[model samples]
Target: MKKIYSIPVFLTMMFLVACSEDFLDLKPIAMETEETFYKDFDALDMTATAAYGILCTRDIFDYYIFMGYASAADDVEVGGENTNDWPQFQAVDRLQHSPMLSTIFDSWGYCYKGIRMTNEFLSRVDKIRATDTKVNQALVDQRIAEMKFLRAFYHFYLAVVYGGVPIADKIVDPSMFSTPRNSLKEVYDFMIKDLKEAIPYLKEKSQLAPNYGRVSKGAARALLAKILLYESSYAKNYPGDERFAGMQERWTEALQYAEEVINSGEYQLVGINGERFASWRNPNGGVGGYRWIFTLDGDNSPESIWEIQNVMDGKGWTYTRGSYIVTYFTVRYYYRPSDPTHSDRVVGGWSFNLPTSYMVNAFGNQDSRETGLHSVPVDPKLDPRFATSIGRPGDTILVNDQTEGEKWFPMSFSNLPTQTISRKYECSPQEYWNGRTNDNEGPMNVRWIRYADVVLMAAEAAYMAGDKPKALNYINQIRKRARMSGNTGYPEDLTDISFEDIVHERRL
Candidate 1:
């Protein structure tokens, strides 16, 4: 009996002793840690790829938070059953929001999450470069540059939206969570520096062909120019703000970078009928130029500078890869098959972010026959892009395989007179009926930046630099493309251009 007891006691003592030395210090088993994860080039690439994933998250692009910010503009109305339906957006539209607002918090939190991801990736890659010789050095450099660009991209939004933001240049310890926001100038400077460093390593879009979604040298340049243009414009507006001191002079640098992207010859505006850059992939194809730019088929066109790639996983409410925001813009329960042949007619959505009458009216002279939001452009003197931009009661959309009946305004849903659906970002019937995606996961790539935007930025910068002809020529080019997109002879090239003209073109 004594000997048996002794044996059991001895075994128990051995187990405890074994655990005492390193039980808490054990490497993570359920997930990868820094030491265990960054073991190879593929792992490093994945880590870099994860940083890009945040751009597609609900906090960043998939939800109403960012679009809510746009609602503050006069063109859009936060449409639902009532003003309180989406109070977060309502607050933003009313300019009554605070940091405590959930959308505001989400935007700030997710941006930092993305920033931390990029910072950690950069650190891990740097360590790998220092210790590993077997890895491809060129790929390492490019990945590092890409991470830097991503970090800068995340920081750029924070600076623009919240003014000052904490610069997370590395993976920070939890204890340092209280890090204060840096000054606006400091934040912008960091972003500019990152882009400049990234430019040399990033391949041009031409070299990155067949993989057009990746960041390119032109993307970096365009972003840098945009940041500089923002800074220059802001400084001019509030010259007394010391944070923006000397930024007004940055317009020249902005123009230089903008022109660099333009001269790179890597991007072009998609012509009237998918003529230019025909090789670009569009899964569900269409014909209208400006309209096609927003569809699933327009995924990685030459015009897209930095597009966020989304997929239709059909994993509704399950963290799917699709851009759920499309659901919000779609017409609410607007699906009704008028004919047996039109079984796949237009589907409905949650009915948010409806266009205002003012926006539609801005496109052209409203006909007397048009009544409120039920606008009918009969012999409409509207801009050609207007047909593709705002989907009204009479406008017909692409059903599955054929063009079908006109879409009616959801009068029963809401009574707002000018409440009209935005065709620009809504999901198509094929996207819904394809058995993959639903209202929650529409597969549409958000074109974050485009070559057309770069051209406009160049025009703005040139105008600021006191070169009127250069600015006029740039604006005229955009107008020419607009006409081509619409297949209309109106909206002719301007004889002269002003700062207001550039602004109006941008609004379009």
Candidate 2:
């Protein structure tokens, strides 16, 4: 009887111990604990994917809000406004800040959100087990580097637009909601540090598939070069400020980085010529021609360093469809005289930001860039880019749907006298409203960074560093590529030339 009692006691104890162990194992799989998610590679990849999604947001591209507003606000381009709705943007000439500036502010918010996500990923990944079999530690490192580069890029954009902004490294906790702005110098310091740290770990440009236009070594260098140029210029223009004291040093550094990209030989300029423009008449010829660079399908072009991808057929369309706002704003009914019945359809009657006579006169006498990218008078005396860029009155080209007898189509903008204004940056009439139709040409892919910008930045840096010959060499390369005639404005007597000339060249 004693033996039987001992057995029962043993069984009860064993059952109680098992129950305790089960209670201790109550961790949930669906809601990943910090140890399970951060301690692995799969979770990190998911975070990276999430960060990339931010690039597709409407505020970044899909329309003229970001690039159009910012660039147009400067002297590089102008827009026509027929109405008072977007009055603030029209007031760019007066240097008035308006609601349109919010587009940039929105970009800042999105960029920070992306940065916070990236930081979260980086912080957690660092703590992950080194011995973990599933994680490729190198990839994690590279991704972290990419994230840092992206963060720097975001800050750079902010600095350029607002001159200064608060710098956030880690994800801000809910309790810390408010922060003061940092000086431009402080912001740039942080940006440079981030880019420098990332450069070593980033992959070469060649390794990236066309789809992965994400941050790479070349892009990082390009951005650094651009930042340095801007800093140098700021210092030169506004002296006596300690913030810009190291401008020359930064300019030298900018040249070094830009040269790295140039030597890498990873990018090539797209060849644009009369044949390229004539091919626009072929619908199937879109991708094969340079015009494709203007549309969503060209997001993955080799020339694209970074571009915002837009899709019109999606459920949550980030880009607006219909007549592009640019077309409605810039193109007048008189511009397309072929449709005589619609000659009175002056959609956007008000010319908001008219190109100053000064700007129009500034175009180089033989510069094709101006004529190719804007619409001017039909007179052969004017620049070619004028016709290409903007639709002028009494101009005709072969329409896509032309029949044999009507070998060519005629488009006249005689009534639309202001057709001489810049239109390359603006959307076309059909593109303004209905994005789904082929008639609309406004839903274009926005090229955030490109080779031309990189080249110009390098030239500016070289000039600032007192390397006039090198600067002129770089500038001439771009000029020649753009089909401009004559010697690059870089004068033989560097003493007479001013940095202002270089800046003006860049603006043009």
Q: Give the CA lDDT, 0 to 100, for residue 145 in model 1.
A: 88
TM-score for each of the candidates: 0.84, 0.74
lDDT string, candidate 2, 1-508, tens digits: 9998999899999988778666878889689676676656776678876666666565553344533464354333344434244555445434665544755466677778877877777677666636458777677778888888878877876676677778888878877677888888888888889888888888876787654546778888888788777777777787887655544446888889888887777775554321342233345533222344444444455556665444444334443322233443344433233455634433332333344334454443233334322222223224333333444444444322222232233443443334454444443324343233433334555577777678777777887788877877776565444443111222112223345556545554
lDDT of 1 by residue, 393-506 (tens): 545444343343333322223333455766667554545544543456677777788988999999999999999899988887776776766556756777777786787677
lDDT of each: 0.73, 0.57
Global lDDT of model 1: 0.73
Model 2 scores a TM of: 0.74
Best by TM-score: 1
